[model samples]
Target: MKLKFFGAAREVGRSCILVEGKSTRILLDAGVKVGEEEAEVPTIPNSMLQSIDAVIITHAHLDHCGYLPHLYSNGFNGPVYALKPTLEIANVMVNDYLKLSNPRDVNKDWQKKMQRKEKTVEYHQEFRVKDLALKLVPAGHILGSSMVEVRLGNERILYTGDINLKTTRLLEPAYTEYLKADTLITESTYGGDKDTWPPEKDVLSGLMKSIKTTLDNEGKVIVPSFAVGRAQEVLFILDDYMRSGTIPKVPIFVDGMIGKVNRIYRHNVIFCKDELQKRILMSEDDPFKSSNFVMIEGKADRSKVLKHQGAAIIVTTSGMLKGGPVIKYLERMGSDSLNKLLLVGYQAVGTPGRELQDGAKEITLDGKKIKMGIKVETFHLSAHADRPQLLRLAGRIQGLKNIFIVHGEERKMMELAAALGKHYKVTVPVLDAEYTT
Candidate 1:
């Protein structure tokens, strides 16, 4: 068996991996790295694209499944496999990426063709791709995120695709029962010593406190969130808090593509936690239909929402403040100290969100330097597992011998590799590196 690291090798995006077993080759997660001047796709050559037999997508996140249309546009014509909800969400995410990035080569025909080639599978259902067998288990990161388990001949390999071991308000924890693998490929997005998070109560407490402070001042709170996972999680948190009287009930203006994706999430509530599904099905407390949440219809609604009289919570997308309705909100409300900008996810380097987190008083947006006085606070509500959770996850897999850490910065990957080295053989591969077992 052989493994090639095409992308997400000692980096946090473009997660592409190739697994070759005898005469069969499978591509894992053909994604693209965002938050840069230009998005970066996997380094695999076009000539080698046709040689791959299949593509397995772990989730719908841009960094994990964004490059499928590009692959289709190039030359690859194999089947694309994922969960049903992953396919649904990926359609929205990839369409949004193409619209924003405007990659001239990928046309509408290629995107429609890619959509036609999708093959959805159920969790834990063993499927075959020629000579290799594969199954997907819940990753607990998002609605349809999964960890791929592959079996080739006598060897078993587990690929952790952006996992989360801790359960959140929307989903359950990752699946880890009786899993046996010889080789483990894991993501190290939060694999450093300093990456430990506070207790869930404390994290929520801090977030509510910030929101309450802004609302008490009769000011709006702008939360820049990823439309897929983070936005839904934040909405659920806000709804739960307000219903319990923990925070003031205010209008939550859902802008951008978040409302569309929220409907997809609601349609796929079976993949969520038992409690959430029960609430959606058995009672009148459907979180998605909460009276506090208001969907922004278009540019007119956005303008009207900004002019609302009293305190409100505006949850809009482009989570990293790269580009979206959030920017418009920031341009209008960011200079007011009474307003608050709450960040709930990781802010990559060079992003406007990261700049704000680093205490930048002024930032360049659309070629103009805008002064920011909106109180900024970050709550570590990340979807990835932290260092301790990663270690505990690694320790739970039975028959694990070799560990390969990917999808992280060099320092964090090295830190995780060093810690995992004591018990198992750990290797942090660089870009285009390969290993055989």
Candidate 2:
């Protein structure tokens, strides 16, 4: 078998890997970089583009499955496999991408092309297509995230597409069984030596304390979160704490794509953790259906929300404040000294979130310069495994000959390679690099 790294080799976006067996070719996780004007896609050979058998998606994150519709525009017409929930979420995301990326006249044709090529697969069930035997295990990153195992000619390859080994409020930790493999493809998103995460308990306590301070001042708290996993986790945390009287009960406004995503989460309870599934089945109380949550139905609702007298909590997207309703909320609340902005995830370079975290006094948004007056705070609520966790995962994969590290910055990947070089041969692949195993 031969493996090729087409994208996301030395960088953290556009993840595409090609696996070539004796008789079949599979493309793993065709995706695009976030926040870029033009997409960075994988380079496929002309001979193999029309004959590729399958495209396996590990999750619905844009960096993992965003570029799938672009394939249909080309000559390739084959099955695209993912978990059922992934397809559902991707249905919403891919359509939204089309609206944003294309003009009104040409968007419909692109949307129809993606719909005809999508396929669904069951988790943990072994299936075969041509010369490849495939199975998907829970990756524990998002609602339908998975880790894929491919078998060909007596050799097994395990690909971890953005895995998280630690538990979050919404899902269980990543599956950690010692799946033996000849080669392991892993993510190095948080593989640097200084990437140790703070304890979850402390992080939560600090977050509640910040909210309490804002509420005490009769000011609103703006939480700019990713509309998917981060939003759901924050909602569950707030609801759980308020119900237990551990924190003040306040109205939480769910905005952006999060409201629609909540419905998807409710519909797919089977994929969640056992505790969450039991809460849905064994109890009458639904955790996602909190009375305190108020949905922002349209842009007209924004004025009413901002004019409210009492304290409130507003959760909205784009997590990095690059776009979406979070900017509107920031424009309204950022100049108030009593209000607070709580950041709950990694802020990529050049985003407004990173600027605020770095103590920028002012930022330009929507052609207007806004001064920063709200209290800015950060917490480690990432979905990726840190250094020790990454090493532990590498240690657990019984026998491994080659380990290819991707999905990280250049220095971080090298740091991970240095840490894992003691026992196994670790290679940090560049874009379009190919290797035989």
Clashing pairs in 1: none
Q: What digit string (tens of lDDT, one per residue) describes model 1 on residues 165-242?
A: 999889998998878899999999999979998998999998998899889889999999999899999999999899
State how far residue 164 of model 1 sits from its true place (Å): 0.6
lDDT of 2 at 124: 85
Query: What do the candidate models score in CA lDDT, each in turn?
Result: 0.91, 0.85
Runs in model 2 lying further than 4 Å from the true structure: 45-48, 103-106
- Find the candidate with the highest TM-score and give its number: 1
Clashes of each: 0, 0
Worst-scoring 10-residue span by lDDT in model 2: 102-111
**Model 2 TM-score, 2 decimals:** 0.95
Model 1 local distance difference test score: 0.91
Off-target runs (Cα >4 Å) in candidate 1 are: none
lDDT of 2 by residue, 297-380 (tens): 887887788777889999998889877888888888899989999998778767789999999979877668999999899988
- Per-residue error at 269 for model 1, in Å? 0.8
